[model samples]
Target: MDNNCLFCRIVAGEIPATVVHETDTTLAFRDIDPKAPVHVLVIPKEHHADVVTLAQNDPAGSADLLAACAVVAETEGLLMEGFRLLFNTGAYAGQEVFHVHAHVLGGEPLGPMLAPR
Candidate 1:
């Protein structure tokens, strides 16, 4: 775990988060700044800068994250209406935290994936 990483701190129990689900390899927590009715962040316990890094470095952990996201979506009652699982890679994508995380969003109409430009 990167000592300076925010998500790593959360995984390390140095920070507090409203955790919804946890497995041996992953964790699902509620987002402090909720963009939707159901906004949870699912992350691997292991540290990786971003999804690309995670996938390249730890394939099993990447699968664990996806499994955790599915469980979070189901637990949050987003299965029927569907949901979005997003990974904001870098600054251009507005990834404030460097650690890889999957944002599970649903519980209402989320409109489009992006604004019309």
Candidate 2:
């Protein structure tokens, strides 16, 4: 775990978050800043700086992260209307929070907007 990461703190119970889905491997919580009617951040319990870092640390976990998107969709009731999953890899990619997270966003038409720039 990264000693100074915000998500690590949240996972370790040092900080509070509105959690929706949680298991031994991951945790899904409401994003503090929501871009949609239903915006959730699906994060790994284990700490890694970003998706690149996560891939290097545990490639299997990286794949698991993607697979976890299904759970997020089912839980959030976005399976029918469709949902978008996004990962902001680096600073230039708009990854403000260094911790690796998947944005499971949906609940509206959202149009043709890209997930993240």
Candidate 3:
């Protein structure tokens, strides 16, 4: 784990986060800044720079993260209405943290996936 990475610190219990769900390989927590009523961040326990990297290096880990998404959606009561799973891969995608995370957004009408440009 990168000692300086924020999510890594959270995984290590060095930084505090409002955790919602956890598995042997993943953790789900509430996003501090919520875009939707139910905004949760799902991450792998093991550090990976991005989802692309995680998929390349650890397929099982990637699967675990995907599995956590369904759990998060169900727990957050977003399954009935549906939800969005987003991964900001790099800076251009507005990825503030280097650690890979899937943003599970729902709990209300979220509108279009992207702003009209």
Write down the worst ten-residue block by lDDT for model 2: 108-117
Give model 3's TM-score versus the native structure.
0.97
lDDT of 1 by residue, 10-115 (tens): 9999999999999999999999999999999999998899999999999999999999999999989999999999999999999999999999999999999988
- lDDT tens string, model 2, 1-117? 776999999999999999998877888999998999889998888988898898998998887887777888898899999988889988888999898999999999877765677
- Candidate 3 — what's its lDDT? 0.95
Clashing residue pairs in candidate 2, if any?
none
- Model 3: lowest-lDDT 10 consecutive positions: 107-116
Superposed model 2: Cα runs more than 4 Å off: 114-117
Task: For residue 4, give model 2's deviation from the true position in Å.
Answer: 1.3
Candidate 1 lDDT for residue 117: 95
**TM-score (C-alpha) between model 1 and the true structure:** 0.97
Q: What overall lDDT, based on C-alpha atoms, would model 1 receive against the true structure?
A: 0.95
Residue 29 C-alpha lDDT in model 3: 97
lDDT, candidate 3, 1-117, per-residue tens: 899899999999998999999999999999999999999999999999999999999999999999999999999999999999999999998999999999999988888977889
Whichever of 2 and 3 has more lDDT, that candidate is 3
> Using Cα atoms with residue i matched to residue i, what is each candidate's TM-score against the true structure?
0.97, 0.90, 0.97
